[model samples]
Target: MTGEVAGGRVPLPQRTAEARLIVVARAKRAEDYDRVLDVLVEAGIRSIELTLTTPGTFERLPALTDRYGASVDLGVGTVTSEAELARAIGAGARYIVTPVTSAALVAQAREAAVPIVPGGLTPTELFASWSAGASAVKIFPAGQVGASYLKDLRGPFPDLVAVPSGGVDLDGAAAWLAAGAAAVSVGGPLLGDAFAGGDLAALGTRAEAFVSLCARTAH
Candidate 1:
């Protein structure tokens, strides 16, 4: 990957390499993101992905981007189709993430100069996404494969840029980074119950903890 991403922006992979973290949120409703995101932003999270599974995300995304776009890389994830990708870009998604390895999506992102991180679980899938020009490939269900899975992958794909997502806790996040993961994309484990009206203070604490942990392990 190039040092500068398309559109002359810092590549998402570089941001993740430096921050070593990407916090993903899948709120039931779009309005719930405001408070949840405030806590994350305050905790110094630079990469944040809001999924399309949440209702009203496309409609409310523009405002969210307007509010936090400059300070953070506000992205859209769980993208499944060309229409959604178009809508995400129109709504100001700084980066695009998919649940599957798709070269088409990566090309689309390039057309808009938006970085794309496509998800895949197996080694072949992961390499395919990276080869297709994705900023990085997400290791979905990384917990099943464990942290060492990334290390093993590096044996064959020494320069592979990966972000382990799904079922990762604080320790698992550290483990992934230790194994050469570009970043750890954490969701439920890090979010806890923040969107379920859980404690924002507690959420902040967790976020801060992950941020500190990643910073300490960052290469």
Candidate 2:
């Protein structure tokens, strides 16, 4: 599972099944982040994205990676700058995600031989990111446009791999997948009230629901 893109060979992280359901986690505290991630992993969610906005995220990456590296595919998200991208790679992130498409970010990922999922809304933006060598173009706020937008986008860029992020809930996961999305990135709906001291058991239930939804939608 290797391919050359922008003069660099794509790594396993860029070419694996982990992308099918990327769980985005944003916590106010690192401890809460760890707790949520542990529960998610135990619930059978292997792909996890830790947002840079979370406090102490960068500092905790090493230990997090060490603790779950074997069973989890850990990635860093919400990266908006080249410096943050560098920090993520240095912290041993398996993949990198951004909320905006940046040619510089794509180039940096190419240089580091890491996988990057850059965000975009319009078709032009998505194509631009793909042209710049993004492993996958993330359709941020996908809920705004819904699955039909993804279906429409594929009509022109059939080869483009897209991951619908933001506001995607269990009810809509299958629709997104059916619309030709390579995967889906979920946050709040999937996390429920876990970040605000909600029940871990409840979070686990939601995680299982998502996992089940993805399984049923798998082609």
Candidate 3:
């Protein structure tokens, strides 16, 4: 199954490498999701991930892309199963991320040359995913392990594209990137119920700061 989404697209690895910061927004409503998208766009954040667990994401991806695709690399996170992969492609997901590695899914992505970032926790698991053709291996629940662990992982897997997701914040985003992460995913801190609260301005500020912080660390 070729993995190309509706539009002929750029590959995910290129997008991740170019994106200094990736914002993962988990929201319960379309309005909230849109609000977060707006903030991220306004703040010059070019990469955004709307997790499958986020309510209204499936309904919102297309519209969001229609409006923001020119400036953003829109993606779906926490994706599992071939059905979700097909749906995400239909919704114009430019990138796909999963909490675990699946060979079938990797094959599906590779068929179309689209990027697939699979999650893995251990050295063995991470390398396994890499060997399976994952564009990047996500260190899920990274906050629990901390940036120091990333430093250690890189020592052995210097060429690996390790993305530290979950519990990552603006303060640690730089550290992760500096440690050789292709990119870092920041959520909770960027949205933090602000969307549900309808606080777009606050969300915008947070997004801008996070972008700025990532930029600073990247250089």
Candidate 4:
């Protein structure tokens, strides 16, 4: 798939499925995004999701778009309300990601021509999001359910597109992809101390590691 929809905007599903790894970033401060994102982009990480839990997400999103629009797909994650969703889109987020399943947000994103991936744990919640026009459903806390859960999900909903998020380590990411996950959304394990006094050089190394690993499983 080209990943683009009616408005020429690349849908989230196509992008994530192709990239195979969505780096979930959290920073204590907003300005830290510049260096962190720079390291990730230079390391060949194509898709990055900045969370609302971080400060200055809405404020700095536009600048981030201008800074690294081509090399990386910049999106907002940890969204919970329609207002936050609206702000994210207005601030130049290419896509939206929620930590919970909200069909209202999914439907709104569909209407706006922006692909959204909403999180859910149960089959019912996931199916509701997917059916509601979600670009892809996020299988939250994927480590808890294990890769086999996705294999099971395919039994009832063969076409269910899932991005396994939350607690997915490097090996877990590979395992999930092997189990047929559309992509893997990874945070802490990949990022480590990059946000704090952690070594950015090592962060770049980890970023490259995950990117290389994910690329091996590309659809």
Ranking by TM-score: 4, 2, 1, 3
lDDT, candidate 2, 1-219, per-residue tens: 123554452433632354378899999977777888889989988789999889888999999989998888888999999999999999999888999979999889887788888999999999999888788899988989999998899788988888999899987788999887888899999998899989999999999988888777776
Model 4 lDDT per residue over 58-174, tens place? 999999989998677888999999999889989988888998988789877776778789999999999988877788889998878999999999999998878999899889989
User: What's model 1's lDDT at 102?
Assistant: 84
**What digit string (tens of lDDT, one per residue) describes model 1 on residues 1-219?**
223454423357445557878899999999999999999999999889999999999998889878887777878899989889988988888788899988788877876777788999988899888877788889997888999898889898997878889999999988898988888899998899999999999999999999999999978
Candidate closer to the true structure by TM-score (higher is better), 1 or 4: 4
What TM-score, to 2 decimals, does candidate 4 have? Answer: 0.94
Provide the overall lDDT of each model, using Cα atoms, as 2-decimal numbers: 0.85, 0.85, 0.77, 0.86
Per-candidate TM-scores read 0.93, 0.93, 0.89, 0.94
Predicted candidate 3 versus true structure: per-residue lDDT over 1-39, tens digit per residue:
224433322235445567667788777766666656776
Error of 4 at 92 (Å): 0.6
Off by over 4 Å in 1: 1-10, 13-17
- Candidate 2: minimum summed lDDT over ten consecutive residues — where? 1-10
The numbered model that scores best in lDDT is: 4
RMSD values, in order shown:
2.7, 2.3, 3.5, 2.6
